[model samples]
Target: MESIVMLSGNVKYTITLDPSVWIFDDRRQDLHTYFHEQQEEKDTLEEYTKEVSKHWDREIIEGAVVPPTLKTEKKYLKEELLTGTFCIPFKPFLTNAEVSENAKNLVIETVDGMVTIPLTVAEKMVLGFSKDGKPLREDGPIHCYYGDGSNYENPIKNVVSFKIE
Candidate 1:
């Protein structure tokens, strides 16, 4: 006698698992998450600065100087270049920084510590971060301005800037 296969009411579903699928990468995942978090933090900071900058003046710390200001004289205009503004942060030895012409974006290091000048979004993008994901710089023609903070100002040593004009 031939046995008949039962196809009664109950339907059983089988889910096949592929072990080869990428479940987790403790190292790479962590690194990626870290970078993402850093980018978010940077964005938050930039946003906060953009909002708060409308009110307060920008100042940098120097050796035993109480909130030093980096002012300049151009065309007989005694301007508080770094006051209440963002200075452009750049590599200490880059040549393009001279474009500002007022030393408005210039920052000096004192024996006591480092000082930073405020910079605008344009200045920050041009001075901070590389086209290929590297350290902060002050070269190349200015291009692009990121406001939402998906990226960050690559924290280069002794560097910071804020807008003036």
Candidate 2:
């Protein structure tokens, strides 16, 4: 299967996505745990500012203090990269593509056919690229999992590209 997919139509930018690189992306989430957790609403900008402030304070006061668990965390992350199932939520990519306000739906072009979904629903979707630390080479550049977890067991696979309409 091809490792790249494109986001095109009704957008400001045509994006070429390489799912293979997402394995190392910080935005990649653990697919198995994604659905089980309830997401809490928060002001991300505020949270980010607070974290930066804390880091700045520490840098000025303590001259940089590294957590003791840093090494352990790195080790665990390495292990996870070797064995974890992961996914990248599609919201960011769609946002970057700048979907046209007139666009009402997104058509997922697959190897065999296409599936159409509302733009709102498309924003909540997740692109699963890895399973058990392996790329989904048999039938996927990605598998799209619904935002509402309605199709977790059987996601939309064989996706080749997305056309906004």
Best by lDDT: 2
Residues 74-145, candidate 2: write the lDDT tens digits.
Answer: 999899999999998899899999999899999999998999999999999999999999999998979999
Determine which window of 10 residues in candidate 2 has minimal summed lDDT: 35-44
- Residue-by-residue lDDT tens digits, candidate 1, 12-120: 2212211112112111112122334433213657877887764344333233344323332342232321121121222221332233444343232322344444433
| Native-referenced Cα lDDT, model 1 | 0.28
TM-score for each of the candidates: 0.16, 0.88
Residue 80 lDDT, candidate 2, scale 0-100:
91
Where does model 1 exceed 4 Å of error?
A: 1-97, 101-119, 126-143, 147-165
Give the Cα lDDT of each candidate. Answer: 0.28, 0.92
Summed over model 2, clashes come to 0
